[model samples]
Target chain A: MDAPTDQAPALVLGLDVGGTSTRALVATADGVRVGAGRAAGGNPTGLGPARAAAAQADAVGQALSGLDPAAVRYVVLGLAGGAALPSGEDMPAGEAFARVWERAGLSCPVEYQGDALIAFVAGTDRPEGSLLLSGTGAVAIAVKDRAMAARSDGHGWLLGDRGSGFWLGRQAVVAAMAELDGEGPPTVLTGLVIESLSLGGAVPGTESASVFPEGAAPVPASPASSASASPAGPIAAPIAARDLVTAVMSQPPPNLARLAPLLATACAAGDRVAEGIADRAAAYLAATLSAVRGPAAATPIVLAGSILTNPTPVAARVRTALAERWPDAVVTPALDGAAAAVWLALDRFGRPPSPAVRERLFSVSTAS
Target chain B: MDAPTDQAPALVLGLDVGGTSTRALVATADGVRVGAGRAAGGNPTGLGPARAAAAQADAVGQALSGLDPAAVRYVVLGLAGGAALPSGEDMPAGEAFARVWERAGLSCPVEYQGDALIAFVAGTDRPEGSLLLSGTGAVAIAVKDRAMAARSDGHGWLLGDRGSGFWLGRQAVVAAMAELDGEGPPTVLTGLVIESLSLGGAVPGTESASVFPEGAAPVPASPASSASASPAGPIAAPIAARDLVTAVMSQPPPNLARLAPLLATACAAGDRVAEGIADRAAAYLAATLSAVRGPAAATPIVLAGSILTNPTPVAARVRTALAERWPDAVVTPALDGAAAAVWLALDRFGRPPSPAVRERLFSVSTAS
Candidate 1:
């Protein structure tokens, strides 16, 4: 291939491909951002490589709309679940990345990185630290020299992921079911569940039935409508419990994570059961983080994901627990993933971005 | 409907309808078995009323073949999860039962009983007792005067059923995933899981990658063929772990129960992890049983369902644990459910059968 030698490249491409969404950015060698684009999630593990590659390409194509491909030099992409791929020539969405760049008409050596390293780099420039993330799922990773050294408890929903949004949501549903069945003590979660699932009205034809091994009785529910008014635990019409169960069993298990938002509302209303769940979630999260962290606690522990990033009782409790356990650890939020990815692309070329350039990218990403 | 009134009717219909299968029995008032039939499960809660009614009709029709429906003096239909239905004309698969009788051209009143009571009646002529059942699911029921007085933890898969087959199977899968991931201690469970799920081979194209919130690394596994032969924890080719996860995720959650049979083989081979799981399962089952039992220990507790009735480590442990907790509690096996339903029908007519008749029905049922 014939090429003109430019002393300084005008643009470098950086991408943060996540399970829910994919983002792309193009910036100058000196880290002055020029373009950004977004697309649907491109998690290769969840949504195979072809679909994932398509998303990555769409985002990259948009970001490079007005920019010339020949002007782009260094390129780097950070992908979630990148470590789960096969090695070397097939590393970290290897073929998917190839398709993305080829379709975008860009020719440059692309540095593919895993989410852990990218997230670590996103929060701090430090080479060694740890990361604890609690989103729909949860995981703890120890990073050393810009690479994932060790990790724990990201085993998916069927295996582990304790203290995750899915876990909390499951707890909420289980509690509501138990309370309405008279198999558990009263809890505000039951009322919230009735209200949330819209189980307040009569079920169409019959009361819901759950399987039992012996001496079964159809569930006990009066013909009366639901009385889910009080947060202190109103005795709901058992019919509501039946409806609640039907609604839950009808969907995929991961959808339970959607119920996680109910906890915040319950916690605000002083629901003890909600409070208890939050405490347990914090404990579980702390334990998972510690499993990968070992004895050293004096590193920057970047907290990421909605559960840790948002303002909830779970978040507050987790922060407190982490502080108590790792007194010397500096807890930081992962601010700007795509921008941080750009910083890594710059670092890969032996040219670190100035503090001002890093700030500029970080500020813009958060603002957006 | 026109019917011949035979003095001292010669036959009665009894059925045990479950989620997996529906068993129907036709016997003389003196307890001589005339006919028997079984068909696909007719659980209205799971299969819906119309389809469930169809299964019941099929089984009843088969049992009534070559027999005059006019000779039937009493009928009892026992259904699992019968308590969860609406009352009156809709009582206990009400329409489903009506369809069965109408289709059969039988005018006799069809009595509907719950599985708990039928299972309890299967083992005893007495009225007050308790039942502990562990099949695909688990439940505890207290029977007083031949009715369910109190119950606990039969809340289905999502909420509870702690020591049920579903629970044990889930635990086995989770433990296996953990061992292979190196997040937990190495156990024979990993090899068993690999063998059971047919995951010993490579996943078609992927080294299965699970979702993680942050600091993730794709799983670590080698390209070598699976070495799942060693029972005491072989470091399997990571590719096998990838396949194991993919297999587990592909099926419906309850299908995990299919893997439960693997535990018996592992326990026999002296796998510590397998033994631990069985013990824990037994403990949970016992606790659930104890919850509804209160302080009374002299009441007979009929241990019904596959996990308790079958000869496995879980069963043995549960028997021993129950004995230790309630020395005076007579633990009996529920011999034949359909036969028991017939007996209950006889009891309802104020005609407690002779010991010879009970023995004959019970023996005939076991033989079938």
Candidate 2:
């Protein structure tokens, strides 16, 4: 992006604001990069508008600092919440971003879209398609004429999000606990969950073995919880059910996402319990996609979010499920949301880039 | 009770400590109540040991205030946690209650029992039977010779307690939210859930109705969300999903229990959706009971917890299900936990009260 700004060509600014972080890209209509910057999460829905605004401004200002603000012809904003991004009063894409631009010395018409659209464009320059995402949460979107036509299953963790990272992680904990309590089938997941949480051998059983209320006898100790281990790291003692519960409950509910990766690891090693969880996650995601995409969907479908972006078991299973439903559908993996946002800006300005250009933009992508 | 201490006879003390409150009863060998007292909750598993001990001490001191310490020859402590009451060091029933008795100037051998046993005794004098309890939480206990022989599903709100107040209330919210999102069937639960949470047309959608991430078009405004009514109370425009989520997430998760009553009211008024929820709750409870009881469980079946003690549809349904499973089994509602503890105290001392005495003790019961 060091080509002299004195002769800088007309460029557009694209911002991908999400719960985890904010990224911005400034590039010319011809697909040559001009500037880039990033900051912490600026998702107005997840974080408040004020903080989200500050993060957006910080990233956008940095992206434009290396070039003339006047040359930044247009701006496009894509929020992670996709069509569900809160707006009327909360959309940083509108009021908050308006203030963000005014403070950063830029004046240009802006185009706003949900993260799903950006993710969709990142995979292809399609004007109509669908997007399926599963990160801390999960959602499916039906894009028509370059905008969301319909959506499904983004109701969030408590009531919905049946196939999300949070959902998978929660299942892992439930399975492990059930096993430890002698009420479920035994699996290596019991060991993995405890080890991942650093919850096994070292911690004293928080609940007393002689607790009277559990009755005259505690649950017949399962094989997995025979005795407490020494303070040796990794050589976990049979994890106590109480310890597992206290660990899971000590944090914000959504942090369970951190444990989702463990399921893939466990399932890969042929653990039936973990495999069952992975199967359910895949089915749940496919079901959500089915709700918005009618039986004979032939449009392009984009997959984004941490779980789907990586070459994980969950992702492979989901792809297989999707293929079964609509084998001919174009299934694309989303790449470079910031770059996709720029392409969208170009499209809004009636200068949509070619397929090669889309690939080039993705080439400048940073790893998630 | 103010019976004369100068002519005191052999008496026993019983304490029922729960998450909500602690109660104590002191009675003579012949079924005459000599003293009674109550204090805030002293369940060690729910509240920390120190606080639970203090509450238990407060209740016991009051119960024994007018009685001679020498006459208080035996003591019994039953905790609401039932068999799951953490013991080794945490059971307030053990070290904590021992300390409580010492502070109250009474020296007597004590018997510790789970609340299920107390509830079972509250219903009948049977030492071997079964108990099903559902309050803020739920559990099924199999009692043998006045001690917990086996237990099922006291895993608490996060993983178990499927038929509890918290579980039922959480279902109401989930159903209402699903309806509001237009993803599920319609029901009065939608209105009741909103009104009960005070979440409705009053909220400014909290989310910008124009939020871009939910895509370009918002959910085609359902018939329910057409207009925003003015500040006039109760004439709600329509409840917004965002407002409902915000309200539910803003409190301790268990507070959802507050919404359980609305389901009963809705079902009474012939709301199929509410009735469906009630049916599932009953089925879940019966399933839990089935897991612990044999096919022809002939022992007395004691029903405890606020839901079963009342005449709600859920309670009625559960009783019918139990009746179907075991035609001749005795099903009784738990009477008084403190009195039951007192009876158990006498029984532990080989002085089990007669049926007439048990009835007199139940007569002195207080409302929840």
Candidate 3:
């Protein structure tokens, strides 16, 4: 092992590389940590993993400043895209830390693995734990006796995600549009989507530069003139990440546990046509799990991600479904995923920290 | 025999009822002479079978007014939503006509049959011909001799249509929206959809009551007012019948055989997305046909509806698939559906007319 550059015994650094967000946590080894410090940003893999990993390093390094650099002993980096060689061999994750460590003049030996692996570790700390992550992107990972197994349901949001925040958000948008056209079952999200887009501007013609920039260049001659011609909606304008959240939130039924209230208020008063999005969503997640782990892989499946943490009814439905599938497996509630990242990293290094250290590292109070 | 309502040669009247339009035609006893008349408004059950029959009677009455009422011996009405009875029994479709004819103030003998029955008759005139209809709605009808022997599918637009004009058009809209959100493969249809909506005068703030009455209610007061303030795009609206024609016209490749030049131009510019959509549509239609009548059904299948008449690439693809599947069965070019309706109606009374009357009645110039 490389010489432990950081001497800190209390803090264990956890890195979670997701398709959508890359989160880092510094916490005490024992699972009950508040938060030493946290760093959040877009997934480096999506932004081009190499550059994103470098950016992540900068962010992580900035958060670690003024801390006991020598005290830090173990590092756990879990990647969204598993670090598997093209020929299926194991390889180090997309780590820019070596370069970062050289620049910072600090050396901490970092163990690299897939994000699913650490999520499994963080959720249950058992080899047989199953971890599902539904953040900016979606993925599920399972580990048993050090034998790692995984499956990618879709190519993220572009191709498919089946059941994730982005998937639900996208489906909400589709349901909204379909409802607008009087095609599919009604959804409350239509109003929300319409509102979110209007914040940007009118759609289509208004986003000439952003949408069909190459095609619109010759038509306008002036950049200012081109912008003015576009429509006033997110379709025409650049959409923010928060808008996607809003879109997903506004689609669930009221009784649903995931995020149904958003869909309920609209549907109950009778203006909302949000379909049974959560029901379908729960089914999708269950189906994906069953497909991979033998319809009866009934390990304690840990639900992690904003979707699982949804205050609405989706969680309840998911719990109910899992109960039917894995009656014996316990359904654990979701904590802050970033915090899970931290706890996972600590557990990864083999020295689970004390309770006090965990309390000092986790800052869940400010998370939401 | 019942007294002939018209003094023209003994003939039967066939009517193909649709959501937006209703077409009627006259067919002679030989089962070959078919011609189209006017398109009326309203559906069978929606208007009540009584009212629907009256509308059909009026359309047929005016079209054959010059001929002797006594010459028209039997009237066969192939009505929509008349496939199976409420109890799932195969009942004579005459209930629809009797209800309509009684309301029309005439007691002329009328036989009611499912639209698929006539479509099958128009396809082969044999007892067991397979007829596939790909209109705004879709269904398959197979007949053995005069008996309606079998039928495969008809799920309507909401639950499923599998392959139909409505299905294809709706798919086009979805693909366009997906491409807009960068969620799916891109297609030239995005610009087309946008342009089509713009042409429909879709603007922000003022919800068009004429378009969507359900959502036309005043935008509700909500914290997310910003998202709902904007009006939906016209393209995002439920596809209209005319749009279906445009969507159909925009498919088929190589020589641009079926689609408009603009669509062809976009596809030629290396638009794999649009190509994928077109290819999928072709596959869907072929699959639907196979599902209804097995790949090796004994009857020579008739590809009815507008999708077949035009020399579009999608249609060609459907033909190719059918040929590949059957190898031995004959796939006839689509006959004008309304014309087939006319022939079916004439044949129902066992009063087939000469080919001259068929040509004149089915002439496109006589549509108005």
Candidate 4:
């Protein structure tokens, strides 16, 4: 007799939407990936949620095009701008996603959640585990009984997104400008931006008040010298630090994440400005984790997202800060987050995901 | 009976060089105005001390053309970038002023010092007093025995410069964006900036990325959906916030003085962002005063400048911060800092300026 063989598990599409990029994966019922796709994520706040949902649905359909619609049992979307529940519309994000799926003509169950929930599930599928995320935006979420029962801090990128990529980017720009004005020491990035942007000595083609609103009839450019001399330039003259921060957060993949470690290193090297920013970022993350863990004595906390990939420096700093509040807690990294989302979706129906399904989800991606 | 027998004192020209504007006043021996003039203040770091000095010379020549150059017995300049003692050929800011006067072909004894010193002398021409400045830049100075010394906490708007116009502007922008992103509460200033700049969208201009360093330049009139947004627009995106602050600071002189109270009221009304900024600004001023008054604890500190002009909330907060450090020290305000520059100059030479000289300095419309 032929050896007993496991049937192909049902496939589920898991999509993670960030400020800079949108990522999607098709995994078996247990979390083994069978297909994948990628696309640019639109700003739901700027672009209505229906449009965002449609775009996301399109991305999912594109990723799962070759597969039969019936084989794809469910779809889960974790998006960035799902926080603002539309007024007079309960389950607005879900409705938006449902509409998108309907438009795509995909006969599959669709679920929508705040991007933080997926990051939390991705990092800690286990009940009673916490996750801290510091991507373009920052948030800490706690899972209990396989549900998002608790959450701490995701107040956009302004008042707090502390150690987030957006924070790092803002710090870098401020430092660069300071150096330009002879108020601060030169940084490696300062020369990089100046050289990268060709931002010195009254360059031609400087845009003026045209940077104001989306539209209001462009104001005639003042004198040429007036434009070139102020090379902190365009955005520098338009948005307030507050709006610039929001704009930075609006990015799909957050450029600041790439620069955050550099800021941490500079802080370590005695750049007071960088150091202050780093210290604040770490404090913020720790506070967020503590808040998510609640007042419990021994709640387990899980680190998540691109930031926690390296738990040695920044992660370590966050651990130290969290220790101040929650001393008797375990801080662990997530083994498989997106897989957890797939598993959670399956578990929602009655039967738990089987071993074969788990293996498939655990399988490494071929793209990498 | 002869109009209080007012006569012009021995004239001494007082000059102030800043990043954006240059001011000069010719005063009589007794500290009376003789003439006044102003021109664009050259950036020392950008144009170098030589060019900046030449610009000052030109302004002075134009202001004093009709007056007897020989009759102008003394010249004083309180400059921002001219703090360095004269070195070799490079000519630091201090010596550059002397050279500028010589090159201008003016016949008079010229003296130069920091702007902080001039503010102090103007605030407290008495034997002992102090001055605190929180403008686009910030500094604190103390004078005793007709000699002046000072300390500065922030010239770097990026690293520090806390409590300055720049800091306020930066903070305002950050807060406004937070409010717009639904991450922070609504603020009056947010609406003020949006209306003032005529921006339609809550997220600021669409050119945020144009402000970012290494991206495709923003396409003009590409509508909100355009992907080729501006790369240099990020830096100026906060312009609205900065503009709001600039409006507060640059309020038509007489009305501008009233903004301090409004700012303080906003802080008191639970505007945490504004309160935080105001507190930091006060701390910055106090720290500078503490640094300058180091080892000379007994001297009274005469507070001067836009930040401490009146008993406004900001000024009160600054006094409170300083009192925390200097428990028993006095803080006095100065009315006319530029005029005090001329008084201090004559005092430096141990010459009692006659009424005619004082009038020339105070009332004359020509530049010193």
Candidate 5:
């Protein structure tokens, strides 16, 4: 609770609060990181208002330890569900943060922006660019002067999110279901998904008899297979496919997103069905970017989110697609969003970081 | 419950239980309907086991009024979500219905089948055919000897159900959102959806200034427009599109299925956006049918579900697409699934119905 004095150095705080995690960082105006903290999901719309506020406070408080919060001149919060705030509210997140600041006996100005906007800043110092993100959800936003000008496909997991992690994972399950139901070609993904989900025991009535005909080739057993090999069980014994379905149905619906990486792994291992899913996901994401890109002929496009940051087949495909369209478009990967927020906050003080400063901030913030 | 008399005439009962409604019918072997009743949604997987069992009991009890339960020779249930039964359970729906029958003193055998199977029976006396159903959800199943042989795309609303009512409605909302955000072309749906949802008041920060630039054509006002005409409110006032978004977001996620008919209505009225949704929905359905259609060149294909039954543009498009592929395939509409189930049950007693009997049963069942 040290008060700001002539001896205290001015610093900036940057926060990235999302549905899955929250991150906060304090840095000097020159983009040198001073402190950093992390917390669980803090998206208000996803994790109610009170919890979201508390998460942000916890992350910020941890980041501000051993430092004078009063010396923090600017604060920028990049929030995932910011756009979904009730319109009638007056700077809700800001007010909540103000109370937190008061409790800590610190004063500072706070600015809130969409997660996509901060993600764009995270990739590059350019104020204007397009960002294509493919995390659990997928979206592309056209940013101008550090503000969102247009967007495509952030319609949650149901209606759109075409190329998102959720979409890819759901596609893998669909393919597996089709294969098990005898309506689609046999895929390596079927056995892979069964093993990954640990669906060993069978459920009655959904026997493989219908899926695998009398003379059809038997399903390949997984290396880690736990299912009984003997066919001499009771007539009413469960089927492997039925067990897989049960395993999937037992989980909360959104947990399906966890399967995306499995699909990526399978694709890398050369499974045709998995490869197709990855290709289609990348295509969908590329299309989303096309829909939201600005009219500027050579606007830089930043690639953000877990799917894009990872060196997966889908990410490779997306990079190739964007390269074909915008040969000169700077498609940089965003390593640390908190670092991006730090740079953005510093920009508010008319000291936008140079390339060297940006690199230093990214390295320092991501290192901790 | 009425006791069976030595001289009581034997009859069969048929029940069509769905997610929205349940219907039961008692009829003579000659297709003469004696009684009928209806109740709320009875899909066990959709409504859960208890509510579904209760719905079936209510509908069947009402249909059996004064009839002797012991005289009921057989009972066939066309159940939605039937295939999704957990395999380990013995006589899944049967055991549930048995309790109801025991209370009512019914002593007759009961058979349970998927709704698609009954819909196929409703369309044709032929034991083998394909049935394409597109209600709140959509699926295409191949039937062999009145049993489901193979299926395609019944992956519920989240994973698949591409050509379903839910799909169409969700597509409409996606389009409206795009138009509102100035990411897509202008469409009449923007106004219609707003008016239908009655989202009149403004929300802060979402003024249409960015969406509809100055001198650009004004958005077409709906016939029931309630938005302010002045267009000069507080700078923070909400936009009409924002209000529409709020209205949609306020509802439970699955309620998006309710918006499908509005899309259909708009399509019938020649809205391009709606028309596109209908055409795509039909095309997807046709593809689904093709996926599950038997190799037998002249397999009968039955079209069921509200989207197909209502004579909408989507049905017409699907019919055209299906007809072009299977020129000799018998494409029949299902009007009374309960009656169809009764006919199938009667066939179990060595009475495969004649065409005239089918017509009589449909007419009698639908008449009420």
Candidate 6:
């Protein structure tokens, strides 16, 4: 059924919609990429329905630009937060995609799927396996015959999502606070986080300029002269732990997730606190995997998302931890999700891509 | 210096500013309460500066409505988020409170103190002790001479605040989600939380009202004819775990704290999941206390905030856990924080109240 087709050229469109960025690919049935486009977040669950649909249209339009839209035989949208519509509604996510498809003037038959299923397929051609994701959120999904069967811990940041990028970043900030207040062992994370946030010695009232005694002669502001003149130059001032905390607290809450990479860097530099956070994240990911794996035998476990795919200490720890549990588990990183959607679309349209085509698709998509 | 004053019968005012409520009390130096007022949240750090000051002024004006403002010799404010000014500037919190005081036209000298310090004073007359607060947030502070000397785990909802009311509530939701998705054991908390949130049979498209087959008679929408209506009456439809999760996700994130009491109720009713959450909360609280205690000898440990004072399983577990480690330590519930501030003001003004006066103040404040 997945044999290479020698018929006249037909194209398929695949879209990976997420909270941060959306990517779309147009490729031929032989796995040769024809065009691609990118846009901002298109997850309807994250960014409301109208914006989500518009983003999808923009990406799809760009991908199909100058190309014959009529030549596209099928479209597959692999969307994050697409498993369920906004709460209290029972409309299938497919119906919403169909409306967007019609509005976009694309006559191709379109199918919608959860991003996790696409990620699993991106990693392997297996009919059944498991996918562990650790991006801004964490969850493990057991895939049976290319569909989600069982799941664990994708409860978002508020509930679980343990071992996720947000979780690690939050831990980094927590450790920094503890060290700042002398409640825990001093860690380099305190300094690194402060610097990462660009919080210097400019604390109000305590800044060198404001701390001068009344009627005291003002010292020259140059770093070298000021140090000798007043013995209280900005260079001499220490960063207050509370000030660092206040700086962090002032940021929009979700921005805390931005600190995850700094934590990874600190872990590589041998910061105990960062290493601890990494280890805990790995352990959590393992536990999530264990919960979802169930009785499945030596199936491939595809690791997806930034926290798992990135070359960070956490990814290394997770790989090591999972290796100890399921030695025979075919652990692999997911290929490009949009391309995976293309493969699924081909399969659903009764013309699955052959292994050679799959390789070509993965290579072409990954290179781009 | 420690004697009660009969010299002018001067009065003192105390204000306890919290996230949920602002409480103010006016009384004589000898501890005879004269007036009190209540208002919405006054935590400047939680609520913005303008609203926080307005709440303080409003509560103060009400408490002093019939009293002579000139008779008030001193004022002390015990504020939850008053220790640190909002991020960005260096102005001390005292200056901010002073502006509010001047605006309210109170001539008395005012002092501002952290809520934890006042809670310690409220529990005992000692100049030093430890305070453990578990409200919407949790923290432990070691107080020495009415000043915060050491602290642990007040990092707010994003970073720490473990074992807090918010933490417990978040855990409850996590458990409910886990149970709903077959990721964990089912418990009564799943039902209780869904009911508490009022998320019943209203799951958008999946509700009975919307689930009717196309072209089928709606059955007159009568309860008797509905197969789902049965012994449970109009509430026969079991809440879909997905729907409950959707409902919670739809709410403002902080509202998750409202689920804590429901969890406590479930624990009291013998739900294992609720009990587990309670146990974790207690353990986290204990760890926070341990981190802040530091080699102190027989110092009173004042447990303040609703989570600690309320008769919940977490509070009980905390008491038991503390008793095992600090048998010699005096465990006391904090008296009214506003009243404690009054006592501190009197002491600072060289008109310390006697033991009998302290008792009178506590009785009057608590009774109100």
Best by lDDT: 2
Best candidate, DockQ: 6
Which fraction of the native contacts appears in each prediction? 0.21, 0.05, 0.00, 0.05, 0.21, 0.37
Clashing pairs in 5: A203-A238, A204-A238, B203-B238
Each candidate: chain B TM-score: 0.84, 0.86, 0.66, 0.68, 0.85, 0.83
TM-score of each: 0.79, 0.79, 0.43, 0.52, 0.81, 0.82
Q: For all candidates, state DockQ relative to the true structure.
A: 0.21, 0.17, 0.02, 0.04, 0.25, 0.28
lDDT of 3 by residue, A186-286 (tens): 34354445444333432222343333233222221222222243345445444432233334333431111232234433434333233366677778777
- Angstrom error of the Cα, residue B205, model 5: value is 22
- Fold similarity of candidate 4's chain A to the true chain A, as a TM-score: 0.69
Q: Identify the CAPRI category of the predicted complex in candidate 1.
A: incorrect
On TM-score, the candidate that comes out on top is 6
For the candidates in turn, chain A alone yields TM-scores of: 0.83, 0.86, 0.67, 0.69, 0.85, 0.83
Between candidates 1 and 2, the one scoring higher on lDDT is: 2
Residue range with the least summed lDDT across 10 consecutive positions in model 2 chain A: A211-220
Interface RMSD of 5: 3.8
**Clash totals for all candidate models:** 13, 19, 84, 90, 3, 5
lDDT per residue (tens digit) for residues A119-225 in model 2: 88887787888899988888888888787787777766765677888888888888877766666776656656666665525222223322212222122222344
For candidate 4, the share of real interface contacts preserved is 0.05
* Candidate 1 stretches greater than 4 Å from native: A1-26, A39-61, A68-117, A181-185, A201-244, A265-272, A345-354, A366-368, B1-10, B44-57, B68-114, B201-236, B239-243, B265-272, B345-354, B366-368
| lDDT of candidates 1 onward, in order | 0.73, 0.75, 0.50, 0.55, 0.73, 0.73
Tens digit of lDDT per residue, candidate 3, span B83-165? 23111233333466555555434445655566666566555545566766665555555556654655444544432344555
**Candidate 5's residue-wise lDDT over B85-198, tens digit each?**
221133455567678778766677777777777888888888888999887778888888777887777666665677888788777777776676666655556655554565
Ranking by DockQ: 6, 5, 1, 2, 4, 3
Candidate 1 per-residue lDDT, tens place, B249-351, comes to 7776667777777678767767677889999999989888877887655889998878888897899999999889888888998879999988887777557
